[model samples]
Target: MGFPVIRNRRLRGSAAVRNLVRETQLTVHDLIYPLFAVPGTGIKHEIPSMPGVFHLSLDLLDAELDEIVKLGIQGVLLFGVPEHKDETGTSACHDHGIVQEATRHIKKRYPQLLVIADTCLCQFTSHGHCGVVKFNDALQQAEVANDESLELLAETAVSQARAGADIIAPSNMMDGFVHAIRTALDEAGYTHVPIMSYSVKYASAFYGPFRDAAHSAPQFGDRRTYQMDPANAREALREAEADVIEGADFLMVKPALAYMDIIRTLKEHFDLPVVAYNVSAEYSMVKAAAANGWINEKSIVLEMLTGMKRAGADIILTYFAKDVARWLRDTE
Candidate 1:
């Protein structure tokens, strides 16, 4: 009944004891790897900011998929950087776009792998804004046009669905995105495909490395206009309500490390599966610290991932998925 009588250390005593009493366990099945696809052959350029991640071309993507299969990673989130970008991000909806090509190839090679296409226009837009931008001449400012962006998002979603994308993740954070994309997918005979909405994504600084990996950084203004403000908690729930009402199959909280509270909030409030994106900046920091001998990379990474799982994340999209999978296998 007392602290001395009930020894908590008994559960934390050793590996076996700790394993038996572990409240959260992160497995390869719960991990989703993010892969960048560029338009080229035999290309696997390492992202400078993200140490172990690469910008893989379609030709080279299969080899990476081979290793992911071996590691038992069940899901992969793919982002495409096309050779051509435009005002409306036309490349994103192209019939033979980079992501479409890569998705077709990936599904051909690994039929069972859950390949998720990141449906957004930042990388494909020359202006590098998530949505359609219009200048407010009187106000001396540019604003993202939410309604116009929805049409483009719908086009992009349908195209990805056509290319064998098992899941379409709309990360643009535009209003009515889930509804538009869902309607488009259904009209295009992809009603079976699911939508993974980046329901509670915030305009956080933890996305620095991801912009580099996806080539999606804005040329001028930041994403504060479209992405949720980092200071708001109640707004995230409102966003979730909209997405859920629009029929989002999976709800996600981006930049998971600093927003575990938001993750828990969404998980508690929604019946849909909750996804936590351990964004690139978070991964890069751990890699940098581990490289400098400041921390044990394996132990820290496991702890961080387990923390997300404990916070009610059903799946985590991280750059460290491959490494974590290998670590999990070896430790077993």
Candidate 2:
């Protein structure tokens, strides 16, 4: 044989050696658990499409937080399912709203846990859109009113902060939304609370399960007018840039698996921490396949999470947070 001096197989010869050469590491601290808060006591209903995820009511939240704390997960992102919905999503701004109430309860019980409130009107809006809608008679269509939505978004952020949220995450992809929210937080004496902007959210089909969880499917048109197109990489950068300039403390890319390139791009372009949302659809697919015996759930999940970290995600907002954390603890 010719001189085969470079033996790449040497590093792959042993499991311990492979692990030693691992390029990325996934840990409990890199996770941000995403929880759904609904209205009721003693209620923990599993989302049908998302196997292990549940919509938890505040009455049972203390025990749930106890379990979460035991898993060594330090952060949580909350999405609220309010009892009521309206044209302007006024309920989202109420200090007594589901998210606000949940925030207060969670923070009071687990003062050390970092609570991030998802600031958006979709879950509270009657039309299930992210912003205020107006019918355009000239075009014979309904569209999100960008400027009108800014005030409501700001109000919602302030309410979340008052209710003890450590961070306000605005997923509503409205123009100038982050700037409005940052100013609102500061003016409301919550300058310490940070804004985690969903800066590169795409108008993706990977949000079906989330709609079921939050009851946020738009009754009319799609969100393409606001959300970025999956085909466009440059637009993602533009969106992230705008949010950064608008004072976003952290930037997030939604439906993380399909947007790993976007995540990498943002991490390379920005100095701030990059968050990736391993969205409900992504979770559901894995769960469904695992339940059907199509894949080894644990192994695949670890691989997927490690891939996200390798792609430069500083934080991962995932439905598998609790399970993954437990698995890590047990394995370790």
Query: What is residue 17's positional error in candidate 1, in angstroms?
Result: 2.0
Model 2, position 217: C-alpha lDDT score: 95
Please list all clashing residue pairs in model 1, or write none if there are none: none
Whole-model Cα lDDT per candidate? 0.92, 0.93
Tell me the tens digit of each residue's lDDT in model 2 across 11-125. 9978899888878889999999988999888899989888878899999787779989999999899999999999989999998999999999998899999999999999999
Residues 4-93, candidate 1: write the lDDT tens digits. 576687678888988898778789999999888898788989999999899888878878999999999998999998999888899999
User: Candidate 2's C-alpha lDDT?
Assistant: 0.93
